[model samples]
Target: MDIKKEWIHFIENSTEQEQEALQVFLNSLKMKRERKSLTHIASLLQLKTNLVEDKMLEMEMPNSPLLDNSIGIVHGGLTATLLDTAMGTMASLVPGNKRGAVTVELKVDFLTPGTGEKFICRAEVVHNGRQLVRMEGKVRNEKGVLIASATGTFFKLAD
Candidate 1:
């Protein structure tokens, strides 16, 4: 397909808001390409895994306009995504784990509007069963205000 042609036509007819949306789309693609070796979702969210300690993980992401919704706040879905990532990482990175895990179920509770320069997400492994893992996660603003809390269940991969 002629992506250049479609882009030219879009550029000619797009409004200011549409252009902004296009910018965000392009940035997401760029991030996905750059972080392909790691994780596309992490790149899209610009998440930094700042800590990986025993049965826990800590990460951070900026509250960018690209991640904002119509109200100029971080979208709830993105918040959930970060929590999921944190919990999943905790499950996968546990010591002597021969295989990773996939989330089987997730539950999120949004506590407040997500507004801040950045977000801090932390996850702890609540239980590590032979075939399933349970995790708890919390997302907070830079000011340490809780934004959302979550629980996740992951199914461990068979070795």
Candidate 2:
């Protein structure tokens, strides 16, 4: 099975709501692509912000050839990217006219190798401060076993 075929299979198996969510995510990616030089690598890897609440976020990505290492496991860098995106997005959701935030420090621990056909990362804001925000996130494979965990500090950007 090639990468495209695998993606098709995953989509076919997804629920209607999940497919709708994916379409919205892709539209956001398209808008971002039109405005900046950003490559949307995370989006290409199928990384998505599936849910966003007050202080919690759910993100997911489908396992694809682009995210695999030579031995057929999820690449560490790709995993890190997923964590960073989820954590950063959670931090940025802080209300008000608080400009934006950037990840000041990110630390990831690889708990287990990811070998499934899907990956999910969940992030929650641990502390939202005046100038800095802290978030913790965990990445898990399809079976719900932790593959990696991360903590990040984001510095609030200027107005």
Candidate 3:
């Protein structure tokens, strides 16, 4: 059968809790599809770029099963992605510059399990050079517990 019919059949057969999970998953997928301005991965994670200014970027992500691991905590890889994205955003957004940057290296230290109602990532450029930018970021839970810290190096893209 086609995917939509199969999805409807599965929804009809699922238990209440399962249905809720599926609904949340579907809503996330719908949000990704509907929000066209963000990059695909950013859309998938439902990240909101809350702040961007000189040398810094801040983004927020809501707690969702889509970001969770088998143990019901946020996945480490997702945390890394969040930190990298934030750092990369800060690295690339230099005043009077139109170039973008791509990650050359990312080193993440997962300090604590990502457990919270929401998470925020704050990234700041440590060094911004003509060719390379160095950035550091921290992921914090809703209560301000440090979940992870990351350092990243990015190279500017040619215009």
Candidate 4:
């Protein structure tokens, strides 16, 4: 069967929890399709960019099974992705003749297991230079425990 037909057949036989997960994925895709202003990955991940200003960015994402690992906690890569995205946003928004920026390198330290109902990432530019920006970010769970920390370097894109 084709993709759509296969999806229908699979979802029809899925458990309630599986159906919910599929629905969330579908909604993520729908959000990306409906909003051209948001990045596809951000939309796909259902992350909300709460703040984006010069030298700082803050974002949040729901803690659900969709993003969890086999061991029942948030995946390390997802946590790193959140930190990277936040740092990149802050780096790109640096003041004084800045342009878009792309990540040159990212180093993430997983401090503790990511748990809780909601996760937040906060990033700030540690040093802003003519062509390179250095940023640091922290990820915390809903109860305010640090889950991970990251530092990233970004190179400014041309005008």
Candidate 5:
């Protein structure tokens, strides 16, 4: 069967709780499909925050099995991706920044297991230059328990 049909079949066989979980994943997928942008996929996974120009960028996401690892905590790769995203978002807001930045390097320290109802990340630009931006970010739970910390360098593209 095709992927869509297979998804329907799986949903039909799943318990209500499982179906609800699947729905969350499907909702994000649907929104990304509608927007037709990878950026939209990132936005779908995150909640809005006070991430304005030249200010700290914050992003949050709810606890969902779709983002969890085999042991039920958020996956490390996802945590790193979110960290990078937070930094990049802040980089884009730097003064005189004519273009958005792409990750040149990202280093994350998984300080603790990511466990909570929601994950929150906050980032700020440490150094904004013409060609490179450096940012630092931290991820915590809703209860303010630190999960990870990251520092990243992003390369600014030409206008």
Candidate 6:
């Protein structure tokens, strides 16, 4: 079946809450797609989210022409965006009444130039509190070599 048909079928079988969540995700995807022209390269690179969890998550993208720098390696800003997105997502997993969090600080260390078919970023929460969250992020090539690492602090917003 085509993707649209498959999506329709899935939505038809989903519960009300699942459908609502799916709608939210789809709306977010649509907004990202529509606002591409207004977004920075790094923001566009991080817009794609592939994994989600309460305290951890991973995102990946295949090496493509759009992601390459003059030397054919993933750009440094793209790597930094991946790290920041991962850490921010981890912070969002903090338990609460679902108040939002904003990144207050982020620091990234580039271990090596990333030149691979695929890039993966993993983020985990190290500490969470009522008002603050700390997270660590790592980027790896398909071969599991660490390409970059980062730490972030996020502030929970009042609901």
Number of the predicted model whose lDDT against the real structure is largest: 1
lDDT of each: 0.86, 0.82, 0.85, 0.85, 0.83, 0.76
What tens-digit string does per-residue lDDT give for candidate 6 at 1-159? Answer: 999999989988988766755655555466668774224443445345555667788877566555677887889888887788667766776786276678899999999998897888998889888788988989999999899999999998886
* Root-mean-square deviation per candidate: 2.6, 8.2, 1.9, 1.6, 2.2, 11.6
lDDT of 3 by residue, 96-154 (tens): 34778899999999999999988999999898887899899999998999999999999
Better of 2 and 4 by TM-score: 4
Residue by residue across 131-150, what tens digits does model 5's lDDT show?
Answer: 89999999999999999999
Compute the lDDT for candidate 3: 0.85
**Pairs of colliding residues, candidate 2:** none
User: How does candidate 2 score on lDDT?
Assistant: 0.82
* Model 4 ranges with Cα > 4 A deviation: 97-99
Give the range where candidate 4 is weakest over 10 consecutive residues by summed lDDT.
36-45
Worst 10 residues of 2 by lDDT: 35-44
Residue 151's lDDT in candidate 2? 96
Off by over 4 Å in 3: 15-21
Task: Give the winner by TM-score.
Answer: 4
Enumerate residue pairs that collide in model 1: none
Candidate with the larger TM-score of 1 and 3: 3
**TM-score per candidate:** 0.82, 0.74, 0.89, 0.92, 0.88, 0.68
Show model 1 residue runs off by greater than 4 Å: 5-28, 35-37
lDDT of 4 by residue, 17-118 (tens): 788788778888888888842776786577887666666778898876688899999999999999988888777777753567899999999999989998
30-130, model 1: which lDDT tens digit per residue?
87887642776687677888566788889898876678889888899999999999899888876545689899999999999999999999999999988
Q: Which ten residues in a row have the lowest lDDT in candidate 5?
A: 43-52
lDDT of 6: 0.76
- The candidates, ranked best first by TM-score, are 4, 3, 5, 1, 2, 6
- Candidate 6 segments exceeding 4 Å error: 1-43, 46-53
